[model samples]
Target chain A: MGIRQVANTEAPALTAAVDVRDLWMAYRPDEWVLKGVNLRVPKGQLWVVMGPSGAGKTTLMKVLAGLLPFQRGTVEVMGFRLRGDLTPPSRRVVGYIPQQLGLVRGLTALENVLLGSLARHGGLGPTLGFFPRSEVTRAREYLEMLGLGDKAETRVFQLSGGERQRVAIARTLMQDPKLILADEFVSDLDLPRAARILETIRGLVRERGLTLVMNLHEIQLVQELADHVVVLKDGKIVYHGPAGTLEWSSFRALVEAEDGRTGVAGW
Target chain B: MAEPGSLAGKGRDVNLRRWQGLSGALALLAALGWVLGRMGFFEPGRLTGGLVNFGRFAAELFPPDLSVLPVVLGALIETVEMAFAGTFLGFLLSFPLGVLGTRTLFPRPVVLAVRLVVAVTRTVPSLLWAVIMVIVVGLGPLAGTLALAVYTVGYLAKLYAEILEGVDPEVIEAVRGLGARRHHLVRYVLWPESANTVLSQLLFMLEYNIRSSTVLGLVGAGGIGFYMQVYISTLAYSRLATVLLAVLVVVVVMDVLSAWARRHYLLDT
Candidate 1:
């Protein structure tokens, strides 16, 4: 069966791809990183989570990706309820892009992308570094989509920062995830490259009806690309509204005020 | 006489500090020398006598008897076979133990248990293991093979566990995030990433086993070392010289082969 068919069968009919309610997380006792975060991300739209450094944006992304365990929360991703432990089925439908890009430096772009189909190929084939011809073609196509067709055989370490990010995106795309969680996805790119990467991701989301939850630092890019914006401050959601309606100056003021109070500064 | 504020006074002060430091170092060295002397080190009589005996032994080893070439070759082959079989067997057995011993992949208890077994095995030297194996399996290559295999398992298992644990956490996390099971994580990410180091370690173990197996015969476990011990007891210096030459050639050959394998396989990766 195709990966999308399997994903569709696993995920029941739900309007919201991600449904997080009363989420509270802490890396240590007595220090809460995310405080009662409630979010409802509808399918097939780009939602950006923006905040200053240490505002728990990356923490929330990790929680959604099932990498971090929360103290108290109900996280539903791709219709599967994540209650501390993430099931294999839920993981198959959620793609995570970490801030470091998460690409193996020694592996070529094509080889890294081929790793995304590991779950679909039943583990053994991919483990042996063998991908079926169809999967190989699809991997190439994903690389091409991310504008890395020419550099498929290039080792990831040899690629520039922006190129490496594109390779990461291609790898994520190859997973055929129903929902994608990207942390600082374009933070390494130049203005034009960032715009291009975001446009490509936005196009793919619209075309494939994939849910995108991204943590972005660029205010202008967030405004330009985000369908909805959720502003976090001091482990709490300060604003959750449409990106177009939110004023940049007010959002910056709220972030700066929190930064001054905590002696932590970031745009 | 120079004024206190003059450059000459400063130079005198520097010289004074240097002299003090030099004297302190000299005193420390003298103390260490006295301690070493107390420990029976660097005795001129024994040192000169030992050097003279060593030179006589070296002179006797020259003009080695090539007449025993056939017997020496056979025993050398036996030693090589023992090392090969032992290393291969140990490598096969170490796989599961190494996987289980990895702290990142398995639970704490499982890792601890596996590591405990590895540590216990590692504590026993290969030659000591050969002595025990000689009692269990009787004399010959069988005992040597068994001893080497056991020792290799202990060493390689710990080495492999360390290599697996040293893999990039980011790569592992990425794979795990993609719904990879434990086996999948090991087979795809861990093994491929650490293949070069693993291969290099394996080659090193094989080389070590070869050198070790040659000595296993010293305990009647079978190899050129058995013949060497017999020759020494019998005062047959010529045959002992021949045996040592054979061992030197075999070790050199093994080293070359191992270096080639490491370069070809590991460097390419």
Candidate 2:
């Protein structure tokens, strides 16, 4: 595989929305999930992280989202340097969509979206279900933007898988975050729906000047949506470059060689 | 030597275990029989005498004295009020205690400390608690209500802890990631997710407290049981019968009402 490094000399470290240096994470002693990882995402760019199952894809996203505390690393997201502790940085800057979507199934779609804005409104009002009217309106606007305005009052468990995915996206957007870490966000959707959602997400990222690091198994979507791509294998990056110049055939072989089976077959 | 796959070695071990289990069961049976003999459970003379006394008592219980109906009804109302007030007070305290006792929410030391308090409180029956409260606070409905509330806190807090612990961890993690504090989690995620179960348990506790509070008055804690004590001491079996009948009807009614409320409002039909 030909690995071409994308050099953005014009965009310095100051422009990096996400920067990770020599990150190492382990759930237990000496059993590392992420090892010596380094990543830098420039402002207003969509980056896709692709790897085979259990290749530390989700782990990397968890560390970036400040959900998982790494043993050793420097993770700086939206100018907040993460301490090696359980205390996550400010919720206003980073929004994370886990693989399960991390939604409260009992909550309404609108209420779930409103959760994103709770950090902004301190004290007991938000905790007691009294969100400010302006924030509530903003949540509705996010839902409307994601085409879930009609289903705002519906419970998350009642919504369809695609609709739920859209709700997750809308909720993340409701946080008004400068950085988004979405792990397998569209993996549940069909190709067409995934494409539509990705397009919408890309448009939003561009318009809002947000930086996104999304983990995906769909090579086609990765090819289409990624401004840059970082291919991880066994807790380390094997390839990092522009999405346009990524050799798809070689990339597939590199990830699928160990399983000896094709995933998301040829296109 | 028996071959690795051969049943000879395994069969011998299995036979030995079976014999050990048989001996254990036989020993347990022998112990139970000895305890029963020691307790005079096998004495036919004592058993017949007890039955004869019970028959006479049963005969006296008939033709219940209706003259005390108004007085019994007033005492019954006091019993019901005591149960309500006690259970409400317990419900108030249980939320915080439950949160502290929840293993998922609190640290090991906090959970252990809260659990220890709950276990100690639950170890004493509500009747015993009423006796203590009566001595401490003087005889009244206040003593009975306080006793019931303390016992309710112990029982309900343990249950609430279990419910809080059983909430979906993923949802909690998600909310925590959104920079939610511990209290925020209880209010938004844990409470909403487990509301139905928690409410149903509360109603069941109320029902149980009602039954318990009826007996608290025997110890001068103020309820229908106080009247029961008076009649029993005076050998007024008919009057005792009236109080017993009233208690039975109220208990049955409460059971039905609680069941209906749980079904109609708390549970998902």
Off by over 4 Å in 1: A1-14, A123-133, A150-160, A244-251, A259-267, B1-39, B267-269
Q: Which residue pairs in model 1 clash with each other?
A: none
| CA shift of B112, model 2, Å | 2.6
| lDDT for each residue of candidate 2 in A1-267, tens digit (9 for 90 to 100) | 111223434535457888799999899999998888888888889999988788899999888877778899787777667775556554578889888888887789999998887777768898778999998999899898889889999988789988988888888888888888899988888999989988988898889988889998787888888988888888877777777666668787777666433222222
Clashes of 1: 0
Query: Candidate 2: which pairs clash?
Result: none
Which tens-of-lDDT digit does each residue in B6-54 have in candidate 2? Answer: 8998888788899999999999999999999999989889889999999
lDDT of 2 at A156: 85
State each model's CA lDDT, in order: 0.84, 0.86
